[model samples]
Target: HPQNPKPQNWTVALEKYYLSTMYSLEFIIGALGNIIVVFGYVFCLKKWKSGNIYLFNLSISDLLFLCTLPNLVNSYSKDQWAESTLCHSNRFLLHANLYSSVLFLMVISIDRYMLMKHPFRDHVLQKRNTAVVVSVAVWIGVILELLPLLYFLEPVTAANNYKCLDYASSGDPVTSLVYSMFLTVFGFLIPLLTMGCFYLKMVCFLQNRSEQIRSALTLEKPLTLVILTVVTFSLLFTPYHVMRNVRIASRIPALNISGGTQRVITTVYIITRPFAFLNSAINPVFYFLMGDHFREMLMAKTRQLLGRLTTTGK
Candidate 1:
């Protein structure tokens, strides 16, 4: 009897096209915005506050992550994985940026809440020195947390030599699922909960205050920031985590899942990935809105440059 051939998953082809397009767009938009923020911080802004320190770190993280996107875009577009060293380094930076960005966002949330609570900015954590220490600690902590991935991420193994598999697909399915679940809890869930609590408290505090107090404090800025943060998490982070865990679990042979079901899950997981990285593009909005002096200085710099260019033309 002739054997029936297994059905191929066409979603893999879809992923290459989709990711290449999304990543190319993300790299362009994210790079421009992050570069502006970084340039403004380094050149235009003179005085650095605690909040500025945190926002600057966030910009740097985004900029660094955006730098990796071009390479990723090339790989996806060509459907070719990079060499082992490049793959390892690229993936490491990607995970490092992911966790660090979340931690920095959490810090920003806490900083904003404290600013509202202690409007005069007299809290000890509001000090610039304290912010510097906290930023350093966050980088170190993210590195420690992601160090385990180095052992698990093999871009080219005996089984798969051509593709650079993600954490969910590259490593041992059972082990990867366990680690993915752990990250969802510690890396995302905890920080998300903390941000929610602080933002909720900020909202409650604002509501209780008189209209005069709200007007004087400029309630709209922080309110806008809260909305943006919530939107980013809901639209971006949540889906990625859920899909990542499910994708990894489905890969476990013990699960006895049908091939068609696995393919569907994998397609959904692939769709979530670009959204996860979309934060690099979105974080710049936070800088413009929440940064104390950032918007003003950026405008000033823009006007100055225009004036110079006009003079040069004349």
Candidate 2:
């Protein structure tokens, strides 16, 4: 009777072990992969060009977000906040880094656009100092942008354990809607549109830059990067936003969205949270995977690591 009690304290058919394993893998892969990416961009390449600097900062952002994944994994598995302050700080870092990633990608596209439009002006703003200044500004912007999230996040007990939940309990409905709309729109859609338009124009310019010059450069790459970013951004974020509202709308009896639908949406949202994180995880791989220089550096590093391992074993 007790085993088949009237109300179960926890979820059934949750695949808790499997979910925990996946989260662990996600944390490990994200952490190690991003570290390698940072190493590749910095020490291995040894080139700090404008493009390189942008990519490095992008890598750093990914690395920072990845570092937060382990804490999240632990929280998910234990279903509680091991450290409240750490959790809030991680949320801020992750959110800031993700948004900053969008800005840097937009900047990269703009840089490409500038190069395609006026290659002669490259030296004017492509200097190392210029890259450093831009990187500093991007970081500052991220810090300011994420300052709000710090206040919203608070530790609360749910499912008999403490976890970080947003301050929606006190925040007004209108305020929440406005914030969500802006976050979903400006955070994802606008930068996407800007990148798309700029890249399309850049492609047109590249086509006109004479066959020899075009052939020497991998002109298709710019469009490829745009396509990857578009797919990952849309797939990772769109549903999360939709389900978040569904979760809210469920509380209002007048909303008329069925309870069953909302439950299904919430279940799916929980199941798919990890995939949404791939938006940050996959970009660096896409950016550098096929490039000759990137591959060379990666291979050399792999061999050195292997040789060191072999010597240590001896």
Most lDDT-accurate candidate: 1
lDDT of candidates 1 onward, in order = 0.84, 0.65
For 1-314, candidate 2 gives per-residue lDDT tens digits of 14533222233233244445655776676667778777776668876667677777887887787777777666656655666688678777767766788878777777665655555545666677887899899899778766765655655545334555433321344455556566667776787788888867866766676476755375566556666666667777667666555555554556676645655654665555556566566766754742436768878988999999999999
Model 1, stretches more than 4 Å misplaced?
Answer: 1-9, 211-217
TM-score of 2: 0.79
Instruction: For model 2, state the Cα shift of residue 4 in Å.
Output: 16
Lowest summed lDDT across 10 adjacent residues in model 2 is found at 6-15
Best by TM-score: 1
Per-residue alpha-carbon lDDT of candidate 1 for residues 1-314, written as tens digits (9 for 90 to 100): 01312323255466578988998999999999999888989999888888999999998888778878888888877877778788888888988888899999999989988887787889999999999999999999998888888878876654674777788877888998888888889999999888888888878877777566746477657766876796687678899999999998898899998877887898888999999989999899888889587899999999999999999999
TM-score of every model versus the real structure: 0.94, 0.79
In the order shown, the candidates' Cα RMSDs to the true structure are 2.4, 4.3
Error of 2 at 146 (Å): 2.3
